[model samples]
Target: MDPTFLSAVQLAALVRGGKIGALELLDHFIGRAERLDSRINAIVVRDFDRARQRARALDNQADKSAPLFGVPATVKESFDVAGLPTTRGHAALKDATVRVSTLPVRRLEAAGAVIFGKTNVPVDLADWQSYNPVYGVTSNPWSTAHTPGGSSGGSAAALAAGLTGFEMGTDIGGSIRVPAHFCGVFGHKPSWGLLPNYGDPATSSAAGTDIACLGPMSRSAADLQAGLEILAGPDPDETALTLNLPAPRATALKGLRAAVWADQAGIAADPETTAAMLALADALEREGAIVSRSARPALDPLDAYHLYLKLLDAAWSGRLTEETLASRRRDLARLKDSDQSADAVMLRMTDVPHRLWLGLNEQRFRLRRAWTAFFREWDVLLCPAFATAALPHRQDGNTWERRITVGGREIAYNDLLFWPGLTGGYHLPATVAPIAATQAGLPLGVQIAGPIHGDRTTIGAAALIEQALGGFKPPPGW
Candidate 1:
């Protein structure tokens, strides 16, 4: 059988059944990348020789029941892979070779995945478009003109184009979900502290970051579940700690409670996106699942979004260059006390004092509590992943200074963070599933968010959606 668009679970099964040798499977992906990666430009760094050796070793193993046995996969370039460059898309850091593999890479290798290469990313993984001086732009397989959704842009593009077997990416601000939405794939952002993230760019801290987490992006939700099982665990350093995530809540869609939040008051989403989300809700109702459109979390969206911006700024503040931080500090000095725009909040919170951060943390826990209460009534909350579908390549000036039109209304590009930050800020688990397409043929993804540690429920709902409606569809010609 042609394994072009087969899911990771299916590919692993093939290898276990002895239908394909591990080395042969690895070569299949490598040959495909060499022949077809020029158009998508997703796999930027190749390690074919080492991967082949590893695959051959796996083939010789007496037992072949590893969860991801013989799966030829790739990870986001920002992740550390022993001898590869961990340049998060910056040219200056290209020559810096990492001495050790990151935790996730080590875990994947231990679980029997042959990671042959690393994918591309935006400079410092800051923008929604994937382009840098180190690696050229990564284009969408659906349309070469548009982005594949970035930081993890290349990860999504590679999956959409059928260039890899499985992929993992990091998400601080829609890095995984946006790419999955734009490229019509599946992605899962696990609950905070669920997965250990020790392979970041600058630091090697054992403690997890506030809003960032490493998760899986794939062609199927079942692949997402499989990935989480392999990747999620306590930090190896903290040997005494153990992790035990619960199984999926709903076995079927018959009695699932789904709350739909298509458009928020402060955020202006495209009519097409809202319509698609509403249609998904209607589909759920027809499938014997309980659907509610009027139910809300009782928290104000604008207020929650603003808090997220502050925490986000603080979380990623250390990664910014000295020059950029200085510029923001100077800009903050000139801002009026009453200024409350998204950019203004971001600028003012860059070097936020620890004292004020304590207050923000207090407020955050309260909001998280509110979400917990809401989830008690609803199984999952469905919303738009982004304001609209994938946008064209935007490699102009600073991303914060750029502007784009959404739903016939022009707004600052960064202002579009409302959708991603709303649930992510509070450390909730969310899964992105492809459900509709715009008239222009661009894909639309619905965000399935559940309460903290409710990851299984959200993914279970996505499985239900996939069974009833449909799952990942290959972009046009491919």
Candidate 2:
């Protein structure tokens, strides 16, 4: 059987049944990556020797009940893998090595996964495109001209190209879901603090930044569930704490309650994307699921977006240098009260006083409460993952000045944050599943969002959608 397209769960079953050797499976992925990765530029850092040794060791073990036993996978470059560079696409940090593996990496390894390499990312993981001085641009497997989507771009590209069985990626501002949407794969952003962040230098010391999450990315929803099971738990240092996420609300699609939000008043999604999302809603209705198009959480969309932007900027403000902080303060001082652009919001929110931050933090809690109340009546909230499909590589240097054409109108490059931020800002669990393709044949995806700690519910809905529409079609000639 061709191993390239096999899901992680399928691969593990084959290995455990002795239908295929663990070492042989690893070699198969390695060979395929070596042969095809040059075109996609996804697996930027290879660990072939270590992966082979680990696979051989696994082959000698008698027990193979681990969920991910002998599976070959890759993680986003930002993750710390002992002896590998966690540059996060920064040129200066390219040579820096991490001596200890991150918590997620250790957990995956403990689950019998052989992580053979790290995928690429945007510089500082800031942009929507993956390119840095260290690793060149990561191209979409469906079309080399278009990007795979940033931050976790390489993770999605590799999966779409069948170069890896599974991936783990960090999402702060749609990092995981956007890539999955663009590349026609599956990705999950777990509830806040559901997965440990220990050893990830970006959030290693960040205690209050609840917006960022680490979760699984794969070609199948089943793989996502398996990956999350292996990674979710309390951090090692917090031994007294335990997690017991509830099972999905329902196992089947029948009698499910779904809300569809295709386009918000301020955010204009492409017609193709909107059509695809509405079509999915129609499909669900046909399957006996009660689907609503007008249901909302009673929170104003623009107000929610503004709150999300402020909190997001505050979460990342620690990374700003003193000089940058001073400059931003100057920019804020010059801003008029009417200025509500994303840049203005970021400037005003960055380096906020502790008291002001507390107020915004409280506001965020209120938003989370509103979402929680809304979810009580709905099983899943379906929306477009992004405004458009995978776009052509636009590495024109200044991202702040970059513009994306959505529905014939140009908008700020960062506008892509709205949909993901809706769930991300409030610490909700969201899963991205490909549902259709654009006229150009590029992939389009929808987001399945659930209440806080509703990771299983969202993933279950995504799995049902995937089963109904089919999932993870490989790029032609891959």
Stretches of candidate 2 off by over 4 Å are: 200-203, 206-208, 333-337
Cα-based TM-score, every candidate: 0.98, 0.97
lDDT of 1 by residue, 1-478 (tens): 8887899999989999999998998898898899989998999999999999999999999899898899999999988888888888879889988877889888888888899999999998888899999989999998999999888999999999999999999888999999999999999988987888786445355566789988988999899988888888887777777766767778888888889999987677899999999998888888788999989997988999999999998898877889988888888888898866667788888677899999999999999999999998998999988999999999889987898999888888888888989889999999999998999999999999998888888888888898887899998887
Q: In model 1, which regions exceed 4 Å deviation?
A: 200-203, 336-339
Clashes of 1: 0
**What TM-score does model 1 achieve against the real structure?**
0.98
Give a tens-digit lDDT track for model 2, residues 387-427: 88998998896676677789877787777788988889999
lDDT of 1 at 87: 87
Tell how far residue 345 is off in model 1, in angstroms: 1.4
